[model samples]
Target: MLTSIQNPLVQKFRRLQNAKERRETQLFLLEGTHLIQEACAVNYPLMTVCYTSKWEEHHPELRSIVLENCDRVELVSDEVIKSIATTVNPDGIVAIAPRLAQKKPPIPAKLTIVLSTIQDPGNLGTIIRTAAAAGADGLWVSQDSVDLDNPKVLRASAGQWFRLAMGVSDNLHELVTSYQQQGVQIVSTTSHTQTSYWDVNLTKPTLILLGNEGAGLSDDLAALADLQVKIPMETGVESLNVATAAALMLYEVRRQRS
Candidate 1:
């Protein structure tokens, strides 16, 4: 068993914790047995997997599967696993997988989410999970937002990240404009808007626009929306959490089409 944190492979896994290393390598770490199982379910390629001896003993079936599929599998000491993992108390298994490449000629999804400057990893992951559950077609995140492959985002997604079709947009305006040209309605939400979210005809091809948590959508992006609607709230509320607002809007679309 690899016991030393100084082991080359263990050190390499440790480097994956940084965003820069992840970007340069085009690989990210998947912590816990659940995330690995989820990846395997989708046939996501795994380069390497490491686990404590205790973990391997408890997960015999999973060990066999990974042994067959992964290019390399290592039995490491718990201390080494802890050093390589981001979580304080990891579930004892981790895998390294290459980043999902963007789909060229983006899928012409009927209900796509467009997010700008969404910095919170947890919120982004929650939105992804909700979008997948609500049957939204896909999602487009601004390139400047939190890395879609952030470890927290992955864990928060509960593995829906693999199932959902997503891409990053460097120029959101161009993306929104293109969608509009295709006859897709661009929807935005704001407290200032009078139109209720339910009143919007979301059955048509649509792109839902969400913004940063603190500042909200940029005025230029908001102005591009074909429709601006509001979630009805009590008198004193300023706004909703981005993820909560996303759930309301996505499900509203689901409700309208159902």
Candidate 2:
């Protein structure tokens, strides 16, 4: 049992709290039994783990995961485990998982989702989750989007980030424009658009551009869209909530393609 607060591994796990540390070490922390099971199920290369004794009794699957897959496991005191976990009740387990390298070469898929400056963690996470479910092959979030590793976002995503080969780009315009030039049809979601979303050919190489809650897509981003699509709404409602709109469009796209 690695019970001491002064232990070197404990310090190492604490370092994972920072984005710089996670990127530099290629490691991000996954707290709780659900996420731990997710990591093990995906065969994510987990470096280390720590769990409270009580969690072992309460969650047998987590115990099996810790014993079978964790490279190293320490019987940590609850206080020690809590120090590194992000949630209020962390289910008494934390895993250090290495970030997989993004694949090179363009992903050959007709469907993609481009997120621009999406600030809300829950909305961003939900969109990505929906995109994955919709069979989107590439999901690129602009530089300013919320970090996928943020614990709030992780909870919303339900561990989909580990399963999806999503990308992050520093230049939103260049990336979007480049895709537009590549015979790709860029679609923007908007409140007032000439074309209805139902008219879009989702089976083609397409990138759905989404923006921050307040701002919508930037003027430049909007201009780059081959066409903008808006969901139809009833009498009083002006538009769908961002996450709701995203789910409708993405699944509509899936229906169109499938």
List lDDT for all candidates, in order: 0.91, 0.79
Which residue pairs in candidate 1 collide? none
What is the TM-score of candidate 1?
Answer: 0.97
Q: Give me the overall lDDT of model 1.
A: 0.91
Residue 124 in model 2: shift from native, Å?
1.9
Candidate 2 per-residue lDDT over residues 114-215, each given as its tens digit: 888888889877886787777777688888888877666777778776677678889989988888788888888887766788887877887788887777
Error of 1 at 168 (Å): 0.7
Q: What is the TM-score of each candidate against the true structure?
A: 0.97, 0.89
Q: Which stretch of 10 consecutive residues in model 1 shows the poorest summed lDDT?
A: 100-109
For residues 55-126, what per-residue lDDT tens digits would candidate 1 score against the true structure?
988999988889888999999999999999999999899889998684533445689999999999999999
In TM-score terms, which candidate is top? 1
